[model samples]
Target: MKFVGPLIALMLAATPLRAEIDITEVTSPDGINAWLVEEQSIPFVALELRFKGGASLDLPGKRGATNLMVGLLEEGAGDLDARAFAEKAESLAASFDFDVGDDAVSISARFLTENKDEALALLRDAITQPRFDQAAIERVKAQIVSVIRSDAQDPDTIVGAEFDRMLFGDHPYGSAIEGSEDSVAALTQEDLVEAYKGALARDRVYVGAAGDISAEELAALLDKLLSDLPETGTPQPADIEVTTDAGVTVVPFDVPQSVAIFGHEGIARDDPDFFAAYVLNEILGGGGFEARLMEEVREKRGLTYGVYSYLVPKDQAALYLGRVSSANNRIAEAIEVIRDEWTKMAENGVTQDELDSAKTYLTGAYPLRFDGNGPIANILVGMQMDDLPIDYVNTRNAQVEAITLDDIKRVAARVLKPEALRFVVVGQPEGLES
Candidate 1:
């Protein structure tokens, strides 16, 4: 009788569950916009800062300058040399990294709250007064060259290099963010310094913080971090054109397993049909297990261990890709099956069951992305970068659920074009249809 009373109270208390997120939008005294989310559940904090004019802003003949610039930021800052910098970070039990992407450069840090001062100081020094030391420059160049040389021998890397070269054409996005061996060898310390001077500006910066940070303190930290930055810089925008090139391009490799990457141009992040495209993608290939590509290419035919497809919605242009691997003999068959599925989905539209399952997966699995501060921080930053409304994470599943069969058909037709697809295979494949 007493057990029954306790169970009833437990059930009643659980009914009023709610989600709490203490989000504070802080504009630094110096005018940098930052988002601070204070989470007391964990004794950790993370800082993410982004600057505009990323790799796309690299000048002609300096295709990889932005990447090189950010690379040196952590190598030496103020008086700390590379080894000292690394040791200090290690001693503080902090994780710090910086990367340059198509449209921005980002620096992120994660550390325990006890070591907050050290981590923040390091980040501030790295951002404000990066040494760009000549010795460090040379060392980083050598490392980049080593990576370029090694990656040249990898089939997947070769395919990517070719794809980017073919897709973006003369644009900066077409080029590898990491410069070639020749480019890296030609890069001087001055190049990195100039890139840093031009790209890292206070007005173009945005910061996101989560896990144990108040709004006022976060803003003060950001002001110190970017105190040396200029007020503004030239905003470089990327204009990517969709190329219609459908043909088989083989990169000769002696590897036993062939890697196949096939795709065409896709919708950008701001497209109105973006949600529809996302849901259609899941039914077609993005669902992993119940996807058509997996069913046809893996489970049914046993052609490969894994096969999947999705639209990689990016800042400028999106890319739709279906990737799989199989023995050299099975590559052609896999591509054929993928193309056939594409054509069928476009022409006949997806079945009601496929549509229902995709909606269910997208809706039911939505809550998993909100489990932690880290994921929320990432999603928040991405939305900010893409110029999306702050309600994106909240309204995303409703958007997905609203997609009808006609919406799927319309998006599928626009998103998939077999004749425009560029076929890339890294090894010899059987059934040699192409």
Candidate 2:
């Protein structure tokens, strides 16, 4: 925690909450694209990079390759061993995070502006020349296997895994990114190398930077840092329409409570009605305590402590998903209430009051996202990935405010399908039948 205070001060002292954001799109000399938010007040910079087709790019029988590869990035790079890398980063007061998901590999970094060149060169080594030493591989592999063992015993993980199997069939989305313990233990140095190549190529990369940098400097930095990556890697997996098997699929475990994941297909991110669907989800289950599902399942009936639902629009597919937990004997009623609310929302939609409240809250909360340079950079990259216009920050609130009550009703009817709602319950619930 010794480093926490300075990082905090670096970000908050030049906060840009409720201020105009000027985004410039820059194309590096090597044809890499990046979004930049120049905040020169602080001698700090935050950089974010994403490579699409993340864990999904794993080769046949090589599940977890991308995940494992990402974990090894900072372990050793160029001539530095893991300890040397750690000491160097700390000496420079820099931080780096490497992560992967089903759709993308993400890297986030922050360093003092004065140390930009050194920090970037170090990062470039990690990105382009990871050693993946034999010892580090074994050590990280053991850690991942440990997590797989722990996840096996967790009800939340158990339920979600079963749900994905039912929902995605043979698609990569059906499998865990962590892979199985056997698959991970079998991974080789070559597999990690292939995984790294497939994941960090320029063709699928998106970059965003903020704080203490000029546009020309950022462009030059991008070229120097990323020019070594391959132009292309493995091809993305085929797109699959969601598999909706609408019924309760019970994975009975001896537990005191029942955890369930439910929902069906969802709208895409680029849909013209996406905002409407977002607003509708907030009204239905995505919002705080005032959301309809919470009002019905927790506030009124006391079936569970909390319930939440969100729209998942992935690069390959989309779905509306939610989770709830209750005492084994009571989860059935909770599901019943949730289903009822879903049907009601589809049929009747939201009232003007709900619409107005959601708009106000959604719009008001939007600005909080731009409070600091790190978040601003993250937002910029996400916007580029989502194919949003550069002026999106300025126009987003207006779009949310533009949604009408009729729009919500139409999107609700289109998105929520009660008959196709599948619930995967993991536990021993007395009165429930699959």
Candidate 3:
């Protein structure tokens, strides 16, 4: 579908600064609910679906089952084989993507309005009636197993796996989303089917749609696409505490560069202090070259090319985490610098300049993300997942702007624990000991 001048004007007219995004809360006749943003001029629709409790729903001993099932969804479905499914989607000028993450199985579809029915029918088949053919299963399994094998040897992967294990302990979050070698190798067709049933269910689903579709049309589409699924999934995993202790653990690897992942417990997304912590994080590590970690570690000392930190709020737990790579000989100094910065931030808080700059960048960069139909759809779904209000897009910057220096100082002291910081360093660094 071609977008002419009128559509182009409509698209560019709503800048992020204007807070003009009008999001409609849509409820279908069949009782399905979704978020929608109608843009009729585009003559296309972008639909985003998320089945919450994603890989976390993997039953005991079926670690990578959902991951594999997600890959196979588009590989074959209903009467169509893998090749036939690809050909069908291509012929319809539709795009379908299925992916499984730690928290959700995300499916995205884009279809021209002219072929919306056919495209959605194909997508529905892929979701509700995936064939999971043996040949296709083996092919996709081999691909995932290959990645698992590769990740096993990668230093960064090793550090992350060990970090999760150390922090989450026996919780499902500790396990790799793509399952380990033995686990993936042992996953059977029955396991995949069971995983599919447990992961994709009506009660746990969240959806967002953008582009040419209206609320009424989206309601019907929602029911048509997902109504066949079971209403509930199996019991979800329990909430976990980030149990990482203060100190460092060095896994000796024969490499020239050392990779470190460090953090402690983090504030929840809904916490009153979350906005303050968010701004503090941006000043500390999330702002790239302008951030404290970057300026002190990389730009000043040349300890590494990059260093970063972020708040990871999962369904099960929340964490404040960061990563950095440095020459094995210089890693100890880098770790000390990171620890010192953590202490300084926790004790001193950020200045007004830093806070204002963070707010500007955070607010300015947010609206740019809604540049397309698909991204808007995705964002809408994500806001729902985060339990954000319908008018969050308009109000998000105000929340950032309201944070004061005292707020950052108070939240930093509460959330950032310098003594509790744990570093998982992978590589044989000269002067550091665990």
Best by TM-score: 2
Q: Candidate 1, 420: how far from true, in Å?
A: 1.3
Runs of candidate 2 exceeding 4 Å displacement: 8-14
TM-score, ranked from best to worst: 2, 3, 1
CA lDDT, every model vs. true structure: 0.78, 0.91, 0.89
Residue pairs clashing in model 1 are 328-429, 329-430
Q: Tens-digit lDDT track for model 2 on 242-315?
A: 85766798998999999999989999999999999999999888899989999999999999999999999998
List the lowest-lDDT window of 10 residues for candidate 2. Answer: 4-13
List residue ranges in candidate 3 displaced over 4 A.
Answer: 1-18
Please, what are the lDDT tens digits per residue for candidate 3 over residues 368-406? Answer: 788888788999999999999999998888889899999
The per-prediction tally of clashing pairs is 2, 0, 0
Q: What TM-score number comes out for model 3? A: 0.96
Please report, as a residue range, the 10-residue window in candidate 3 with the lowest summed lDDT.
9-18
lDDT of 1 by residue, 9-88 (tens): 34223322114444577887977787766776566676777886688888788867888888898898989988899888
